[model samples]
Target: MIEIFTDGASSGNPGPGGYGAILKAGSHYKELSGGFRKTTNNRMELLAVIKALEAIKKPNQTITIYSDSKYIIDAIEKKWVYGWIKKGFKDKKNKDLWLQLMEYFKLHQIRLVWVKGHAGHPENERCDELAVAAAKQPALPADLFFEAEAAREKLF
Candidate 1:
């Protein structure tokens, strides 16, 4: 079984943001993270999970994911994402990330466990630190999807 702990951080709700993920299998561990100059916390949250899943080498693996974002956890666990997918993700915020995540669902047996943020969980804390540090990087790249969406929204 593989275990993953993830967290996301933003300097502001829709400001600079980043995601952190720690993957553990047997005696091996890996950490992943990236930053965006402009993005939402939820986007980072979802991206963390997607990146972690993409890191796995083998398909059909059993995986457990620990996340602090109820936005990501509840959406999957409560079957909301499935419904959204059926509806072609109409009125959805992060359609790109959600679609990317669902692609991994077919390859892995994934279980999502929500953990309280800043609750002293070691792996969770480490993820949080990684996310925050990434968000602070001097020259993060633009989140193209987010920028395009924001631009489109402004025209309305």
Candidate 2:
């Protein structure tokens, strides 16, 4: 069985953002993080889980992902994403990350559990710390999709 904890943070809405994730399986453990120069918190939230799932090397393993973002957890657990897909994700956000996650769903038995953030949960707090630190780092990579979407919206 694999256990994962994830968190995401942004300096501000549509600002610098990052994701942090911890993956553990038996005696092995790993931490992953990535920062984007500009992005939304929701995107980062979903991306954290994606990064964690990507870190798993074995397929068909049981995996549990813990996260605090309702935007990520509720959407999946409540089966809203599937409905969004059925509608071709028209008028929905984070379609890219959601699609990527759906692909991984085919590879593992995944469960998402929501935890209260900053509520004394060690792993959750650590992931949040990692996310915040990454978001504050200089020379972060651009979130091209977010940037392009922002630019187009600016054109109107």
Candidate 3:
């Protein structure tokens, strides 16, 4: 079984944001993170899980993901994202991320466990630190989908 831990941080809600994830299976361990110049906390939250899933080299693995985001946890575990997909994701946030995540669902058996943030869980705290550090880095890339959606929203 693989254990994955994840967290996300934003300096200003929709401002500089980043995600962090750690994957461990037996003796193998790896960390992943990236930052966006402009994005929401929710986007980072979702992306952390996606990035971690993408990191796994083999398909059909058993994985348990620990996350601080109820936005990601409840959506999948409660089947709300499935309903959103049926509606073609109208009026929903992070549709692009949700779509990307579902492909991994077909590839692996994933279980989501939500951990309370800032409660001193060692792995969770480290992920939070990594997320915060990544968000603070200079010249972060744009979260293109988020930017495009925000632009389109302002035109209406």
Candidate 4:
């Protein structure tokens, strides 16, 4: 089984944000991260998971994801995202990321495990460090998630 740990950080709400992900399968390991000039912590959190899953080269692999975001854990495990999908994600935030996540989720046997942030967990701590550092990096390109959100709002 593959093990994945992820974390997200934001300098401020609607400010610079980034996500960190560490994926381990057998003896192989990979780390992924990216920064956004303007975004939210929650968006980064979900993006971390989505990016990690997208990194997996093989579909149908059993994977366990450790995340500190209750927003992500509860949304999927508690079936809230499913309900939102059924409702066409109307009146919901982060609909773009949610829909993207659900697409990747359907391709793999995935499990979400909630872990306490800032805890002593080694991988989790490292993820947090990566996330914070990415958020502090020099100005990078805009986040597609946020850009998509802006475009969607213009339609209504």
Candidate 5:
């Protein structure tokens, strides 16, 4: 089984943002993070999960994800995302990331467990540190997050 802990950080609601992910499999572990020029916390949260799933090399692996975002965990755990997908994601935000997530999710057996942020979970704490550091880094590039935001705007 693979375990992933993720966190997202933003300097401002629509300001510089980043996500951090820690993947553990047996005795091996990997840390991943990246910053965006402008984005939101929710987008960063979803992106963290996306990046972690993308990093997984093995197919059909049993994976457990720990996240602090109710926006993410509730959507999946409560089957709201499935309803959104069924309706073609109309009037919804982050459809692109959601679609991407569904694709990756289908490739692996995955479960999401929500954890309280800043509650001192070791991996979660490290993820927060990585996210904050990445957001503070200089010269970070723009992410597809803004593109998704633009697409949502066009729908309105």
Candidate 6:
């Protein structure tokens, strides 16, 4: 089975944000991260899982994901996402990422483990460092969905 540890960070609720993921399988490992000029921590958290799942090359892999975001773990574990899907994710915040994640979900058997943040778990800590560092980088790309939503909010 492949194991993935993920973390996301944002400078503000809707500020520079990033996600980090570490994918491990036996002796092999890969790290992934990216920054957005404006995003929410929840989006970053979901994106980290999406990025890790996308990195997998094989089909129908058995995957275990470790994340600190209850926003994700609970949504799936409690089957809330299924209801959201039926309702077309109406009034949802991270619909873009959630849709992407659901697509990836069809390709793998995924299990999510929730870990406490800032609890000194090595892999989780490393992911946090990577995420925070990426968020601090210059010239980060704008998060399109976030910008569009903000613009709509301003208009309405």
How accurate locally, in lDDT, is each candidate?
0.95, 0.92, 0.94, 0.91, 0.90, 0.94
- Tell me the deviation in Å of residue 1 in model 1: 0.7
- Per residue, candidate 6 scores C-alpha lDDT tens digits across 1-156 of 999999999999999999999999999999999999999999999999999999898899999999999999999999899899899988878888898999988999999999999999999999999999999999999999889989998997
Model 1, C-alpha of 14: deviation from truth (Å): 0.5
Best by lDDT: 1
What are the models' TM-scores?
A: 0.98, 0.97, 0.98, 0.93, 0.92, 0.98
Candidate achieving higher lDDT, 2 or 4: 2
| Model 1 / residue 45 / CA error / Å | 0.3
Superposed on all Cα atoms, the candidates' RMSDs to the truth, in angstroms, are 0.7, 0.9, 0.6, 1.9, 1.9, 0.7
Candidate closer to the true structure by lDDT (higher is better), 1 or 4: 1
Per-residue alpha-carbon lDDT of candidate 5 for residues 50-127, written as tens digits (9 for 90 to 100) = 999999977999999999999999999999999999999888877888999899888999989999999989999999
Give the winner by TM-score: 3
Residue pair clashes in candidate 3: none
Worst 10 residues of 4 by lDDT: 139-148
Show the lowest summed lDDT stretch of 10 residues, model 3.
68-77
Q: Which residue pairs show collisions in model 4?
A: none
Candidate 3 local lDDT, 1-156, one digit each (tens): 999999999989899999999999999999999999999999999899999999998999999999989998999989999999999998999999999999999999999999999999999999999899999999999999999999999999
Q: What is the per-residue lDDT of model 4 for residues 1-156, given as tens digits with 9 covering 90 to 100?
A: 999999999988888998999999999999999889888899999989999999998889999999999999999989999999999988888988899999988899888899999989999998988888898889667987687787878999
Candidate 2 vs candidate 6: the lDDT winner is: 6
Q: How far out, in Å, is residue 25 in model 1?
A: 0.6
Backbone atom clashes (below 3 Å) for every candidate:
0, 0, 0, 0, 0, 0
lDDT, model 6, position 66: 98
**Poorly placed runs, candidate 6 (over 4 Å):** none
